[model samples]
Every structure is written in C-alpha cells, then in structure tokens.
Target: MVAGERLKDRYAVDHLPLSHQGMGEVWPARDTVLDRQVIVKLTASSVMDAALAKRFRREARLTARLAHPGVPAVYDFGQHKGRFYMVMQRIEGIDLADLIAEHDPLPVSWVAAIGAQISSVLIAARQIRLVHRDIKPSNAMLERSGAVKVLDFGLAAIHGDDRYSRITQSGDSLGTVGYMAPEQIEGSPTDHRTDLYGLGATLFDLLTGRPPFDGPTPTATVWHQLQTSPPRPAALRPEVPAVIDDLVHALMARHPQDRPPSAAAVYEVLAPLARNLPPIPGVVSDQPDAIRAYAAMVGQVPLPAHHETRDSTTAEYDDPDLATRQAEARAQQLATTGNPRAAARQWRELADRRASQFGEQDAAVADYRLRAIRLHAEIGEHSRALRQLHSLLQDRIAVDGAGHPTVQAIQDEIAKLTQGGLDRSER
Candidate 1:
C-alpha cells in the first residue's frame, strides 16, 4: 500500500495521476486478497446521495454481467470510509476523445471503423437487455491492440418495457447532452435504438471534429438534435465515401425504428468501409507493415510442450496441484505472446489434464478460444478462424443471447471471411 493515501490501510493503492469528467478519480490498485492489477474508482463522500448510491451499486452489478472485449470487467465493489468504490480491469489505451482532439478532422474510414467497433459493443449490451445510455467519443477507449472498449456505465439501463420510468430522474437527462437522442430529451421511452442514435452522433463528432449539435447550452443542443437533420459526412469532408455518409445518416434517424435494426447491422454496413480506415492517431507507426508486425507479436510468449509418460514407468501425472500449475504456466505463456492459437492449444491441453480441476467452459478457457480464432484471422488462416468463430458465436449466444454484439461480431467476422480475406491497408 502506498503511504499518504487515506485508503492505503484498506487497499493496496498505487496512485494514478488520471481524472475524467468529474466521474471520480481512478487509482491503480491491487486487491490484497487477490493480488492483481485493478483500477479503483473512488466516489467522494460529499456527493453520496442514497439514490445515487443505489444506482452505482446497480451499475456495478450490471457491468459485471456484461462479458465482452469492448466492456471493461468489474472485479469488486465496496464502500470504504463512507465513499463507494468499484475495482475494474485496468485497460491500457487512450480515449477516442483525446485521440480525435489531437488529430482533428479525422479520416472518414477511421470514423467508420470506430463506429463498427462500438456498434459491436452495443450489439452485445442490447442482447443482454442493457442500454449504455451514453455513447460518446470520451466513453470509447482504444487499446494498444487496436481493440475498443466502451466505459462509464453510471447511467446505463437494463431492459424493461417502461423505459420512461427506468431512466427519468428528477428531470435531469441521463446521458451526455450532445450525444443524447431526441427521445431522451422529450422524456419519452427508450430502447436499444437510443444507444444506436448516441453512437451515430459520436461518429459524427469524431469525423467532423465537432459535436453533431453544439449550442450555448445542453438544452439547445438537445433541441438541435431533435429538430435538425445533420449534414452528410461527405458534405463536411468531401473525400468521405457516399456509403459512409449513408451509414451516419441511417444511424442518426430521428425515429428509432428508422435506424438500423441493430448494432450488428451497423457493423455489417460499415465493415467494408473499415477496410479503408486511416491509421489511428498517436499510434506512433501507422504503416501497414508496422501494424501487421505488432498484430503478429501481440501477446507472444513461448511455451514448451510437456511430454506424456509411458504407463508403467511414469507416475500417474494426474496430480491436481501439478496439473493446475502447468495450466497456469501455459495460460501465462499464451497471454504473454498474445498468440491465440498457441494459447488455445495450451488451454486444450490444460482442459484434458485438469477437466475436473477447473470448471467446464470457464471464462478463462473461452477467452483463450476466442483469442485463437481472432489470431487465426489475423494470420490469414480464415477457414480455421471461421471454425473457432462459429463455436464462439454458439457459446456467446447460449450464454447471453443471439443478439449479443460479441456473438454478432463473430458472425460479422465469419461473413467477412466467407467473402474473402483480412487484408486491409490503412489509407
């Protein structure tokens, strides 16, 4: 535990000099019991309202239920010294807002790819009956591996028919002003489509380097989003393709029904455009060879294969402790190299060795499996990737729902593979 921090006695805190949007401060921490790196969000006691606390607790629970690459994983939650706090996965990357701000007038293709990525998240959340309620540039974080995560679910809503009752709270809008859908402003019922609208608005902001509706006040912006039909992306940046402009327009439809049926649909519409996306901002190296090399090396670690012993001469190698240690080693090796195939092979070996030791189809194993599929795709082994992707889609659909974005994304990837290959050269 670090000294001078008030919570050091209770938690092993490593102060992180980062803050965002008055949400609260985040500290890099380790759970003394678990001993793993985590980001702890601490709420100041001064703003502890009973209703808000309840909502925060609900947020923690809701976030934990969502297991997708695009959403941060919540580890634990508790109240210490009258201030509520939640520990979550410490993602390594930059928020889209800062990326866009530093590189204004972002390329159209990059914007489309971002839209596709976020839409995948919404698809996953929607499948589980959760609405993020907020989908802005700041809320999306881009990881070093090029994966995107949607964060800050403080105002998210779980599925319920009475959308008005679920989100309305003392007349204060629950989402970011510029990104909020008009239905949200009118205090009308909302559904998964509301999130779609917000995502569209975010893409618009990123591409044009301006919010879709900027006004003197949030109220005015809400009115503008409600009443105005935004200009096309090509209008703002003529170099942008008509297909992309069509996508943005479809996403920003005033009527929920008028928007794309689902985030998966949005991804399907944008996947091709993503092929033309420019290199990400602040990425140090945007060249194709550099990107490919990094992709290949991500999570790369070497693992030595264990030899099986002959029946009479060898000790029955089924010792639970030994098997467990070996499994851990293999998993670590896989994670280190970021090579899904190697990880998958190791996990399969672990499953055979310690089937009873670890629960069947555990998340750890599933993660490895998914990684293998993605890695196969990354390495241009599309057929193999498709096989794993099929199984992954089946598993997620069973656990979550067919509509889940993770499942849908697997399907989208499969579609892409079916058509051709994973050859995209950032313009």
Candidate 2:
C-alpha cells in the first residue's frame, strides 16, 4: 500500500498502517471520491475466512445503525484484493489507553465525564439491542473537543439473535483479560451488563493508574475476576469520591443481577460528578467547537406555553384515588422496564399528591415516599435517598416509637448513606 494507491478506487491509504493487530490493520486514508479523511480497516488475508468476513460486514452494518455523537460513523464496507475492508470516520484524537499512558491517574471530573459519555453511547446501543462485548480503554477515544467516541464494535453482539453469525464459538472466552466480566470469562451468555463491567474496569484504571485486576498470566487474571474483590478506587486514590467508588464496585459485580439495571442508570449516577471538568492541557483544543456552537443556537429555542385553565367537566370527573392508582401503576411499569429514574419521578409525584390529599402521616403516602427513596438509592442518589429516609424515619418514629423495627431500619439506612456506603438491605 502507498499514499497514491487507492482501494476500490476511492480510499487512498498510506504506505504504513496506523495500527495493526491480530484481527486487522487500520490505515489513515483519504477518500478521493468524498474528498475527506477516513479510516480503512482491512482484515489480515490469513484471517479473512468465511466467519471473519461475515463478522466484518456485520460490524460495519450494525455500527452504521447507531446514530450517536459518541460513536464513529461507518461509511462503507467491501472487499479489496480478497481482503474485507471497512471505511469509517477518521476520528482525530488519542485513545483513552494512550491518553492514560501519557497522563495516568486522570482528574476525578474528567474520568467521570468520560465514563458518562461512554455510558450515554451504551444507552443508545442498548436501545437497539446491541451489546459492545469489548469496551476497554483502547476502544474509547477522547477528541480534541473533549467529546468521547466509543470505537471498535468488532465484538458486538445482537440480543435474541443466536442465528446470526458469531466470531467466537460457544463457550469460548473473549475480551481483554483485565476487563472481562466474570460471566464472560466463564463462557456464560452475556448482555448489556457485561459492557458495564468493562466500563468499570476501564474507569478503575483511569482512577488508580492501573486495572483493578492484573496477574502474571491471563489465566490468573481470569481467576482474580472470578474469585477476588478489588479494593475500592478511593483506597488507592483518596481524592476519588466515595459515590464513584461505590458505582465502580456495583458495575463490576460478579453477578449480573448485582449491577445497575441499565447503562442509563449508570449515566444518571455519573452525571453529577461529571460536571465542571478541567480541560486536558493538550488533548482538548482551545478553539471553538462545533458542538458548542450548535448548543448555543439550541439554547435560544422558544419554550412551549403552559396552560393554567382546566375544563370544569374534566375536573369534576377526575377521581383523586383513581389518579393515584394510575400513577403508581405507571411507576411500577417504568421500574419493571429498566427505567429507575423515570420510575422514581413518578413515585415522587404520587407521594406528593398523596401527602397533599391526605396527611403526610397517612400509610399510603409513607409507602409511596419509601418507594421513591428506595428507587433513588438504586440509582445511586445517596444524598436524596438519605434525605427521604431521614424524613421517613421521623414520621415512623413519631407513630411507632424509636424502637420500632421499621424506624430502626430507616435509621440504619440513614447511617449507611451518611457514611457513603451502599444500603444492601432488601427493598
């Protein structure tokens, strides 16, 4: 390959590859037809068997389906000289792995910001029933505008599509050794939670300057993932927030059931810490970003008017009890559908309505409020959870006395939250 040599009469690739691995080689190229910079990934001729070729095409098509700012756009896929090639947007940035190598132990806010961005992309991927089986730091790029782009969907898997071709055989372990989830290493079927585990491992490395589990051999690392519990991130870096430490631990849980229900839930927890990030000295440019310009324009959009008037007939027919029941039902549905944040909002509204209609001391109102508290805690809103728990404790103690088990349990939860620990008690 040379700078003037064209592939498929469109992509003119350089003489040397930007990077190469056992699977394929990536070259920074210029798309002569489109007159834009692009990346061409070509599978090694030796590995361009039927299975690999099918997987390469699948990756290109599936990744193209994902329309997210955090994901690179797939341009084209084809065969060139008997080797499969995929054309993608040439992202200009340093991958997280290289960034970490240059500046280890990243700032807390930057780490949180990068994790949240990746989680946002995962949320999008999850909506389309796509699971990125490999999510190591090397696959996460940090652009000059401070935007994160999740790369490499070569190991992606579609949910409920066992008939589709898979690059790996059944019972065969895949993914980087340090970031593999316990179930993945055990050759068990995986889902979106597996990606969360990988993100946790990546975040751990970002915070502590090393992965949570590393051993002399891959087998030993697998054993560590299956049998060992990593020390909290805060243990290695005292500046790390306790909430982030807890979130990382939850994401890396050995049991899938122990992790957050979805990537959206993880994003909700990380959003607060991701604010007020300090820019990277070199990686983030000082020039105006296109995204910022678009955001500025969007901020000027007009808001819709809120109507204050309600028809008398509609008001007369509206039953408060029925409305409360309906709200509770909606909240339950949202909770069951892997949307804890929306469910918490519904529960909060129900609780407020109940308190306004009846007294705060009412049993139904207390139940709704307790549900909201638990839901908030589930999403790692410890401060809000603690506030609600303390309020509930006061109400329960006033009615059932200080020694009551319910009041005691609430008190215990308050203690745990105050101490920046997770409440493991049954909801």
Candidate 3:
C-alpha cells in the first residue's frame, strides 16, 4: 500500500501505518465517501488467526455500540485483500503515555480530571456489559480540549458471552504487563473491575513519572503484578493528598474485592479533586475550547421524567391487593421506560409489602426483592444491589443446597458485585 492508495475505492490511506503493534497496525486515512480524515486499523496479515479475526470483528461491533463522547465513533468495517480493516473517527491528540513522557509528574488536578473522565466512560461501559480488557496509558488519548478518550477495545469482553473462544489458553496472560490485575495474571475470570486496576496503575505512572512496578524482564514484571503492592503515590510526590493516595491504593488492591464498588463510586471521589486543573503546556490550550463548552451545555440538559402522579380522588385502588398490583404495574412501566431509579424504589416498596402480607421467606417476596436488586444495579447503585442480593442469597441457600444451581447463581452475583467494590458494608 502507498499514499493515496484507495481501499474498497473509498479510503485513501498512507503508505506506512502511524503505529504498528503486536496484533494490528493503525493507519491515517482519508474517507473519500465522507470527505473526512479517519483512522483505519488493520490486523497484521502474518498473524491472521481465525480467533483473532473474530475478535477484531467483535471489537468493531462492540465499539460501535458505545455512544459516548469519550469513545471514538466507528465509521466502517470491511475486508480488503484478505485483511480486515475498521475505520473510526480520527482523534487528534497525544496519547497519555506520550504526554506522560514529555511531562511527567503532571499537575495533581490534571491527573484527577483524567482519571475521573476515564471513570465516567467506564461507568457507561459497565452499564452496557462491555469491559475494556486493555486500559493502559497508550490506550488513552488526551485531546487539546482536555477531554480524555479511551481507545483500543480490541481485547474487550462481553459479560457472559462465551461464543468466542478465549484468546489466551490456560495459564497464559493477555494484557500489558504492569497494568494487569492479579486475577488477569493468574488467567482467572475477569470483569469490569479489571479495568479499574489498570486505571490505577496508569494513574500511578502519571503521578510518579514511572510505572508502579518494573522488573528486568517481562516475566518478573508479571510476577510483581501478581504478588507485590505498589509504593504510595505520596511517597514519590509529597504534594499528593492522603485521600488521593488511599483511593489509588484501593483501586490497585491485590484482591478485586478490596477495590472501590464501581466506576461511578470512584468518580464521586475524584470529582472534587479534579477542580482547578492546570493546563499542560502543549497538550491543553489556554483558549476556550468549543468542545468543552458544548459538552457543558449538553450535560446540563435534564432527562424527561417517566413517572406521573394520579390524583387521590381519581385513584381506584381500594384494597391492599389491588394497591400492590398497581404498584407492580408502575414499577414495570418505569423500568421499561428507562427510569431505573424510580423503578427500583417502587420494587423495594412492593417487596416490603409482599413480605409483610405473606412472609419474609415467601417466594413472591423473593421475586420482588430480586427485581429491586436488578433495577438498582441497572442505575449503577451497586451497593444497594449487593445488600438486596445478600438478603436473597440467604433465602435461596435455605431453600436449596449450597451446590444447587440457583444458590450458586446468587453466590456468583454476590462475588461479581463485591469484586466490583459493592460489598455488604457499602449498603
């Protein structure tokens, strides 16, 4: 391929890729059809394994599903000359890794802002059941507008989808060293929390000008990720706050269960620290950024309410059973209309009523409790969800043996919630 060489007679790409890594190469291209500069990533022909091709296609589809400003928009996907290529919105900025190299020990507020932005993206990704398995600094771009865009979902995994085979065999790790969580290094089942650990390591690097752990060899580095705890950020930079240090440590906890409950929870802690950000000399401009200004206005828009109250004089529920049925109907209406917060509240109330009318251990009451838990989780209320799950688990274990499938399913939910930082105490 050469400069001006057209792929599918539409995208004219440069002769050489902008960057080439192990699995693929990213090229700068002009989409003649759309008349825009876009990024085209192609899998390396030498390593075009069937599974890899499937994963590449999966990445394109998964990335396309994410509709957030923090993520690049996918434009097209097709095969040219037996190689798969995906076109995405071109992001003009330096990656976080390069930014860190040029300006290490970045301003504290800048680090907080970047982390918080990434967390905001993660919150969206988690809700959609997508996990970015690779989340190192190189996978994050810092635009001139000071917005952080997370890239590289090539290794992303969908929750509970096993149609695609595992990329790594037993005992083989897949992510970049230093950023891999302990479970990742051990080849254990992973979830959204894995990304949090990577974010923690990246933030540590940004604050200290070096990775939290670096060994003489890759094998040694993997070992450190599995067995060692990183040094405190305050130790390297005295200006670091104790609260920030603690948050970073919790994020990098050896056990996933020890980390914060969710990305939303992490954002809550970082939002206050992200104030008064100091601009990077070259990366962030001093002039007012139109993207930032536009985003501020868009975020302030309120979502339309889905719930409406009926007048007491016109209400028709005269009996307890009828009122319970009406409440359940309202809860379902709210849930289907995309208002999980109000839906969760209604479900909880229904569960309480069911428990009082029948019994705490009644099957109908348990069902209502489960619905409440599901609705809470849909709205990023993992802490509340975990509390309800624990209650359901006790009832389940009493009715079924510990090894029973239903009992085990509840246990799995508990583990996932806790590992993502939503333990019983969080309630």
Candidate 4:
C-alpha cells in the first residue's frame, strides 16, 4: 500500500501503485528471492465477506491454471494486514485499448495478428474449459514483440464449475456492456463461445476504431448487443477484408451455438493473415525479443488432442489431493515414527505452500505452522520453536488486530512455546 513496504517480508513494494481498478489497487514490486520485478494486486479493503474470499481464492486458482505465454504468470496469492494480494508477473506492453486509440483502424495485418493472438489465448483457455468472460481491448496487452498477452482473469470462470462465488448480486452480472455476449448480458449461462463474442467486439474495435454496436448510454449499448445485429466492420472501414468481416459476425452471433465452434478453429482462419506484420512506430519496440524466437519454435510442436471434461473445475492442474493429501498423510504417519525433524519439515512445507495459496493469516496455515513448532520443541530445537511462535503471533496480531480472541490465543501460545510447552492440540 505504501512505497518500500514489504508483503510477506519478501516482495518489497517498489512504488505507490501502477493503477487502480474496480476490485483493488495494482502496485509495482520486487521479488527479493528471484530478483525480478513483479506486480502486486490488492483488494479494495482487508475486510471481505465469505463470498468475496471464496471468489478471491477461486480467481487465484483459475489464473494459475491458465499457464501460458499469453497469460501473465501468477506468482503468489497472499494476505497481509487483512488485505488479500495477488503477486503476478509484470508485463510491459501497451494496452490494446490505448494502442487502438493511438493507431485507430490499425493496419489490416495488425488487426488480423491481434485478433489471432487473442484467439490463440482463447484457444488455450478453451482447452482447459476456462471462459474469460471479459475480453475487451483494455484487458489485452500488445507486447513489444507484437504478441498480445491476454490479461485479467478476474471475470474468468471454468465450465461445469457451478460452485463459483457470485461476484455480483442476484440479478447483476459483471461485464463490459459493449462487448458482452447476449447470454452473458442476459445473465444466462456462458461458455467458451461467450469469449469469442467479446473477441469479435475487440477485433471490431481494432478494425473500425469503435465497438461493434454503440449507443448513447450503457443501457442502450446493452440493448444493442442483445437485440441488434452485429455491425459489419468492412462497412465502417472499407479496408477491412470481407473474410475478416464474416469471421467477426460469426463470432458475435446472437446465439452461442451459431458462433465459431472453438477458438482454435477461429485461430486457424486468422493465423495466415497475421503474417508479415509491419511494426507500428512507437507502439512496438525494435529490440529483439527472446520470447518471440522461442514462441516460433514452440509453434512447430504438434497440438494436443482437445479434451472435453464435464466434471472438472480447473483446466489441468496437477492433482493437489495426490500432492497435498499424500504428503500430509505421510507427515502424520511420520509424526509417531523415529524421525520427528522430517515430519516437522513436511508440516513446514505444507504451511508454506498453503500460505502461498491462502496467505499467512489463514487459520489452517497457523495450525500447520504450530504443528511444526510443536515438533521442533519436542526435538529440543527450543530457539527455532520460539522464533516461529513469535512470527505466527505477529501475523495473527496483524490480521486479527491486537485485541481479537485469536490474537490473544496466539499470545498465550507464544508464552507457552517460550516456556518449552504447547497445548495438547498442538502436541
């Protein structure tokens, strides 16, 4: 929240903030261990209800699942002083919104390239059954290498994952009015093709320097998207190829079933046109980008067979139950065995991993960390036990406030740990 302040005692806040959006503020930061620049996004406030916290946790899991060059990497999800924070790779690029403004009606090739790049990301998302509900221009970044990085998974959802936390009230759905699909605007169930409609609107903007359907007010804009036929980009910008025009209309079809079957199918059409992109003067840098070269080689690899999962929530994340359950179960078994230190280490690792997911303020994190301290104390590592106890106490106080019951409980635990003892539950 302030310059020079640190989150998790690892990420040092480098500046005030890069920008502020609807959910919270985005700050520029540095990862001390990796020695790399990162961006930290925080919630508007530390106080969030159960639903909001669930949504925040789901967003972190959702974005982390979308591992791709086109998506910014998520580093850590945490909390400090009750504020939930998401640490992500800091992508340097001009927003597509700004790019469109500076060079309205971008060259036909660039339009194809941008649309193709966006479609490529959507293709990746569709593979995992993830729907990026919001796919407008501002949510995309045109990198120096001329590649587009799809940004903001805040509105993303996985298909068949009906347990998603509601980000809005009962009737209100969150989305950009001009770009939302008819079903999305109507609060009807949405899927991958929903994102295709948004892509159509984005490409329409890139081609004609305006949204496909516009009106004087947001209400009117919603009506246009819901009722009016998608405008032909070629009619507004004669230079737009008719092939591209037909593709855009297909993507923005009123019925989801009528849109392009898949984002990959859409990409197949746009990729050929994306060739030989001439760089824009100020928008794209002349510097050689290693990622671009690496991507060229990656393109040659054969695509995996498309998977259509019905019950899965995340795309293709490694089995956490296999990873977490086995480790914790083994740790529990190891607790009564000859090696106490190894068990302690296992508990500590679980604590750290969960801390990365839920933050240090989490009760489960405190529980496992306390287990580690208890084992350390049992093994006569008194100093280490005391240190961890004190650290947990500090975090509890920060998150729960000084006078809260949990803080008081943590204070008592620290006192007991210093005295070479722990509660029966901790033991």
lDDT of each: 0.70, 0.81, 0.80, 0.81
Please tell me which model should have the higher lDDT, number 1 or number 2. 2
Instruction: In angstroms, give how far residue 40 of model 1 lies from its true place.
Output: 0.9
RMSD of 1: 18.9
For model 3 the local lDDT of residue 347 reads 85
> What residue pairs clash in candidate 3, if any at all?
260-421, 261-421
lDDT tens readout by residue for model 3, 1-427: 5678888899999777899867788999999987999999998888877766787887887788777889999999999887899999999999999989999879888999999999988877775556788888999999999999999887777655553225642332478888888888787888778889998998888888888878999989877877777568888898998888988888899998898767777787888898888768878988988998998898698755852212211132113256778898999999999888888789888888665433354566767777878778767888788887987898877876577676787788788877767454575
Backbone clashes in model 2, listed as residue pairs:
none
lDDT at 121, model 3: 89
Instruction: Output the better candidate (1/3) by lDDT.
Output: 3
Clashing pairs in 4: none
Q: Give lDDT: candidate 2, residue 345.
A: 85
Total backbone collisions for each predicted model: 8, 0, 2, 0
Name the runs in model 4 displaced over 4 angstroms: 165-172, 302-427
Candidate 2 per-residue C-alpha lDDT over 26-47 given as tens digits, one digit per residue, 9 for 90 to 100? 9989999889999999988976
Total clashing pairs in model 3: 2
lDDT for residue 52 in candidate 1, whole number 0-100: 58
lDDT of 4 by residue, 1-427 (tens): 7899999999999757889876678999999989999999887784465556566777787788776778999999998888788999898889989998999769889988888888878877866567889999999998888778998887788665564424642332578889988998787888888999999999999998888878999999888877778888988888777789999989899999899777777777788898778879888877887878888898898754664422232223324345677789989889988788999999999999776644566677888888888898888787888888888888888887899777787678677765544454367
Query: lDDT for model 3, on a 0 to 1 scale?
Result: 0.80
Query: lDDT of candidate 2?
Result: 0.81
In angstroms, how far off is 68's CA in candidate 3? 1.1
1 or 4, which is superior by TM-score? 4
